[model samples]
Target chain A: MKTSRFALAVCLLFPALAFAHIGQGDIGGGLVAGFKHPILGLDHVIAMVAVGLWGAQLGRPAIWVLPVTFPLVMAFGGILGGLGLPLPGVEIAIALSAVALGLMVAFAARPPLWLAGILVAFFAIFHGHAHGAELPDTANAISYAVGFVVATGLLHALGILIGVAQRWRGGAYALRGGGAVIALGGLFFLASHFSILPGLDA
Target chain B: MNHFNAGFVHPLTAFEHVLAFAAVGLLIGQHGLQKAQFLILIFPLAVALGAAGARALPGLPLVAATNLVSLILFGALTALAKPLPHAALLAFCCAFGLTHGYANGSATTAQTSMLAFAAGLFAATFLVVAYGAAAAQYLLQRKISWIDIAVRVAGSWIAAIGLMALAIGMRGGLGR
Candidate 1:
């Protein structure tokens, strides 16, 4: 009985040790960790949702294309990160995506579909690189990839839902307001990362 | 015998492979078995050839890509239910089966008799496809629109999974 208990205790500690290096635990497995990464980070959540909102605003083809383009490009970014390639200022750029995408939503800026795709894909590299850089060494790569990609897509879908609210009266205003809020959050994230915001650097 | 068993069990092991055939089966159910007769008959033969080809040429490019695309295309087709030409549908099934068979074939070792492995694979595919089609056909025939909707939603999820796999393959980002 004592041996079994000791085995259980050691098993429990393994997961903790696995996650301790990244400074984020509470979640286990590479796939689950990857899934939660986007949702856990405020910057990733806002930017992903903002992409969906922007896609919804742009309407069909953009709706699907934008979401699809992100992971594809993000994967390329992941490859770069995995290969130990340096991409300067990934954190700053990720924060900037939220700001830029949020502002696009707030102002109801409608860029051409190609342009929107390009913009979203460009930011996705930083996001992907961040994810790739932190991948758990012991985690299942396929599952982790699946988890994060799906999580990102779901966030985009959530934003699309919010953007679709425009079908109702004053829905457009509500969306714009939501965009402003996301943009505000992005600014704070950017500030916090740069230690520009008081008490956030800690 | 172990080789035969391995071949039989191979398709069942992977979620993606099971999902691929299940999607095909679901389509057959939705459209009626009669309409999909050619698909039902030709898919296994094509898979056999693919598995053989894989054994012969281990360096088949785009096997993963093709498999992923099959998932996406089939899932989308299930969701849309857009009427397609018979030939188009047949071609889609054959192409999907071929890729999956190739993957399965390549996975088997040289010690495994290719014939036994192929037989096992064909048998497994047949059972899965037939059972899925029958189940969907029976349950969905109840005239419940929501059931149809649920199937469509499942289709979307499958497509999403495929898209995720595609991204991973593109970047080889999943940690080794």
Candidate 2:
């Protein structure tokens, strides 16, 4: 009787334990994958950070405006991509975004508010398209989208946090230096996309 | 899960629901505590009514779609960080609460007692909204410009999530 009771308990517990798996192609899995998508890509990471750094460098409304503009516009691009609407040269545009945005940071370029918003919006489309197009078929779409967008936003926050250092003397130089490195990294990615960088092309 | 526990956990389980609830609280809280206190009551009442009415409603999908729209609307309103006409805001709160509550209600099993489940749901939803309102009130009291900006940024994040989710849903990839 004791053995039978124990066996019954084990049977009851097994299914519950089995159902506890995390990231196993459920909403949680989709979220994890989507969150990882932007962070895992070096190109995406730098470009997103550049947006924050540039925003900080510009100060005021631009600081907040650029971050707001990116995600909303990115969602539009994502919609286009989800619908299988082809935007020509997505890869090239993504690579170019990094370079251009990074260079803007490196130079601490502060264009007019509308111009800056337009520039950021332009690059956001490519990034959003890349993410939307790459969404896994098995994943929950909403969760996955939430994951990537949140991840992207956090990356911007990270850049903004780092950019805050600019308030101190000599911090500006460091920020500009960071931007140059990002620009260089973007160049490497651009080159690899063209197969011009040996072994770096993934 | 028991009916009460199931109903309690429903809003917390879904990302969109959580966002929408928090956005409503934040938006209301932005105005002032008195407004939040009075306005917040409308949500649970509407929720209870919607949940009760869910048995008669035929289209679960429509409720869900509206819920997503509510997510976007609330997030955008919060991000705008501007005051709106009181009546309009009230209407938004009631409509959203109804839709979201209906969605929550449809998830219930027939074996459960409706009263117990609704009580649990009300408790959970109220806590989330109250917490959000309190947090926003705290930030407003600080009078820090950056805090306001951060709130706006958070609002944008919510809106972005809604937009992406809507797009993906439209693409026929939501539940898949």
Candidate 3:
């Protein structure tokens, strides 16, 4: 059981770490590189899932709207970041986004759809802004945005689909269990944020 | 165009471009001929715009503006039911697309290579859409929530990264 649990935990984090583009090599590798980033990074993988799961937890119109809205808003925010706008507490806010989102899942706190949308959009602004700001001039902008945003939405849909089993035995419990996992991940992120761990600082 | 070893162009030249295209592919479930057709059309147009923008404006600080917008919008997306003002946003994509194109106008390429470069991008985009659609389908068949939690954690982390960008940009802007 412990072995399977370990495997499951690894699966949980597989996407995000796999998709880290911080080390994205070259400027013209184009699609080949785009194809590989999410495959390799765990962070990208998990972020995708959280979108789906949270979308499902909120349910209803949010089930569809929030997921769609996030990427669009995120892309805009990314453009802002790319264009060099001024906002405050980005790093802290990102960490907080992780923590707050995880807690929402852990506590199964279901805010209204509009509120949920607002919450995700706030974080997305930060998320999109950062990615956009970092876009290399040598790289193609729209393509880059497409890569990350698409990966993000798929992950959300996966979460919702997984949440579907919630109708079956242990499904809701499983979701909550997933939340616990998110919370733990948040703790690791926090430790890394404070520079207290030998973390990837992503 | 710069000559690379083995007569094959270096791949990184258009690396992130792949991600953007692939991302859209992955997002919409990859179903129907319409989606594929739409991607084929929008992608090229977007690329043309991006290439053109890259030619006209070359500034690293522009990311600051895009990043700030994401932060504001992310909050709304998670808790809201309203659709974004589609026209303005679509216009943003067009403008944003131009910036991308203009930025890379100087990279390795054929003076006549716009079509080739776009072809490369389209191929990459197709793969991502396929992958995303496939993965969504696969998950629908799985008994998993760990992945969901993992994704949420990542979203949070990304948000944090954005926050950091905001601070750094402000600091740089203030000359402190």
Candidate 4:
């Protein structure tokens, strides 16, 4: 009877064992996760969209240059993060991006193309490094990059749509109001990361 | 079946190839059908020649460096959104299409049926380009500048991926 019981247990356990690692090392799974990384993060969303908003406010060449500069610089940052290079205050910098870009949009600040490009690129490093540091060992590097880049671009697009509201007088005021809200959110994120607020840290 | 599958799967499997094909389409769409006439026609022909050349000369260097470079350059141009002259765009497309076709050709084997492989490759490329061009043309027709700008931003992402691929290649070559 005991032998039969043992045999039955083995049969039952074998099925579970076969699927123990299912979805654990899949490249496609990793790609999906990477795609969701930016979407899942509030900090990333605010800053990425703010970039597009600011670009639209600035208009013309700034519109293209800001977005163009970001991913290129961010890739460098990701490579650095992948190499295990330590970058201090990445979280703080990410939070700061939201604040700065929000204010830029709110004020309708029109910096030169070079300055706008530099500012966006500066903030992108922290965001990219954060995402890159979390890469799965078993993930296809190229696919993961493609996934996250697509996600980031989509976020920027969303911001551009919102920023287009600035083309109208009432819409411009609404965008400014939205920018203020985004800036406030960034400040809250900054405070929370620093553990300055008691209940807010959670 | 194997030849057809191999050809069909090759470009889809490579992010660089997929992005490059889409970028070409986006460019053509942005410039409009009239201005991109030469480019639209010459690209596939160059691709066919490149694939044939690769098969004919098996010992040719297939370093993939050119592919990375093309990805970086064209992606940047797409983001810039400036219209390139037809002659320039045509030359660019021919050069890139040839190089990429060569890479795609390397995937085939002696047992592969030439007709099947060519058909599969042609179908995939045609579809990718056609889809991108149609989508872009639709947005432009609707005057949806937001979506258009989004496409341009996507080009930046492609360039970034190219940079990453380049870095990876360098790291692999340097054994670190």
Candidate 5:
């Protein structure tokens, strides 16, 4: 998966669009709101990327297992977080996950596959905590989680494109220097986290 | 159908909501699914917190501040078209989202305002994002700053509308 140095560079400059919303109380609505949150908000955007980057870097069974496990663990976490179970630093954890995952991708560092999965699953807990904490009274907590998992799997597929995104249609980043620019890309989110970048007026 | 849907519909269905949700859609088109899923899962929780914040404080100008800030930040996001290099977006979303959620909650009656409205608005918001992504797909190769230009232009309109709504709210006292 080799990407052009310039194109991927531009994406890094702009962290990309992410949509996420959380509502508590309505069983159906919560599920819907919960489902929408990750897709809409920017926070979840980087975290999802790290999942794919790390998965790609690790390769193989991880490619299959990591994505599946992450959402499952995340759903569990969402229940607890929405229920308002005490979990310190859920926000911070979410922030840190982005950093950790991005670093993994930037360096193309490959830990053992199982270790990588554990890392993602652990991060998924924080993501879930944040999700669960905001559960709407109307949302069916379990169903809301299922929606997220489905959505998360789809996100992984996009990240996988790095392997094929560069050349054409899915083949873009499969070349040798494809991910050479990934490190710089990681800088955008990391810098954003620390407030080093200029403010976004949008 | 009822008062609940009416109020809930406004926040989720309003043009700005549509545009902001489009920001997410663009993310799916430009970024990837895990990223989109992450946004879907986390933001609402943040909004719930924001809603709770509004409930707790409900102070002067908070609603206006949140709306104005979101408009500006989202407009900037559209304009800049980059992953914010820092927590700018996060700060932006959290402060505004809480207030938005609280506003959503406040908009409805306890009985009618149940989850249905939330679902309606959420569904509508996502549809807009998805549409935005689809709409922008052909132009994905172009710099989003151009998209930002259109967004800001629309944002100016939203600000105008917000002010008018504010005036109307002032006269009527509270959102309808």
Candidate 6:
């Protein structure tokens, strides 16, 4: 009983290390790595969340429309990157996406639906290119793609859930405040890209 | 593992197969159970037939491409939330089942018992389709506005994954 208790305690305490073997191979590793890619990047997170915030602010069809539009456009962009096609200033554009979308959320800017979608779609290209270009040669490609897309969708859902705050009093201001922080973060990323912020990589 | 277990676990193990199966279920389920009952039966039967046929047939080309296309087709259909004629729906489900099952069959060894493997495959396929249908039916019956939007979003995600996989495949990055 004591030995079993000790083993159970060790398992609980070191679960990640214990389960480390699960993701060591091609499929599982690819899934885990792909899921982590967008999430680990602060720039990606903020921009994706800002999309949801802006969508929620726009109300009605735009709320669902923007989230739906993003993944499809992003996949097209991924195809380009996978094909080794070059898109200019990808990193800069990615940072700019965060800045632009963040500001849209911060200012509660509600543009025409088509314009908003076009803007989101434009940014999605940059984000997708970065992910696709970095696709590991060793991992299972299909699993990796599924992992990343699902992760990206969940991030958008998170932003949408946060945007749900719009229903209450002062919630709108809170969302704007969140948007401003995201915008500032984007500027920081941009500055890092430009070498203005030394020692910090975006 | 026994052939039966191998066949049963095969579809669950493959991400492409799971996604395609789920998409079919969701699309059919979105139309309601009464309309979906026929399709639900047709899909698994087609899978069994495809798996059995794989042994006698010369290797089919573009199995991977066809599987990815099925994902895109079924997912896009679900996302659109548009109704199809019964015949069209049946044809789509049948095609999806056959191609995916053939892919699964090609993976199995010749020594495996065809009867046991096909039975396992059919059972697993039926369960997946049923589960997907149930989830979609539950959501639709609830009549909540967000539930409808959520299903569409899920559909789009599946389609996006399919498109991305196709892109990767074009680059020769995807392994069989």
Worst 10 residues of 3 chain A by lDDT: A18-27
Best by lDDT: 6
Per-prediction DockQ scores?
0.11, 0.42, 0.07, 0.21, 0.02, 0.38
lDDT of 2 at A61: 90
Pick the TM-score winner. Answer: 6
Q: Kindly list the per-residue Cα lDDT of model 1 for residues A1-202, writing each as its tens digit.
A: 9999998667544433432223212224466877887788888999999998888777766776676567667766776665557999998898899999999999989888888888998998898888877766666544565577678878877988788887775998888898999999888888898898778851
Better of 4 and 5 by TM-score: 4
lDDT of 4 by residue, A34-72 (tens): 789888889899999998888778777677777777888
TM-score of each predicted structure versus truth:
0.66, 0.91, 0.48, 0.78, 0.40, 0.91
Query: lDDT tens string, model 1, B10-117?
Result: 766555677788888788877877777667657777777788889888977778677877987887787666667888888888888889899878776777799988
Model 3, range A38-121, lDDT digits (tens) per residue? 434444445456667777776665666666567667665765776678677665565566667767776778877778888888
Off by over 4 Å in 5: A1-28, A165-202, B1-176
Candidate 5 accuracy as TM-score: 0.40
lDDT of 5 by residue, B12-123 (tens): 4333344345554454444434344445444455554544444456554546335534643554344334554335544554555555666555544445544555555445
Model 2, residue B56: what's the lDDT? Answer: 68
Positional deviation of B73 in candidate 3, in angstroms?
Answer: 18
Please report, in order, the local distance difference test score of every candidate based on alpha carbons.
0.74, 0.81, 0.49, 0.74, 0.51, 0.84
Rank order by lDDT, top first? Answer: 6, 2, 1, 4, 5, 3
lDDT of 3 at A31: 28
Model 2 chain A: lowest-lDDT 10 consecutive positions: A16-25
Best candidate according to DockQ: 2
Q: How well is candidate 1 docked (DockQ)?
A: 0.11
Q: Can you rank all candidates by TM-score, best first? A: 6, 2, 4, 1, 3, 5
Task: Score residue A119 of candidate 6 by CA lDDT.
Answer: 97
Q: Over 4 Å off in model 6, which ranges?
A: A1-26, B173-176
Off by over 4 Å in 2: A1-27, B173-176
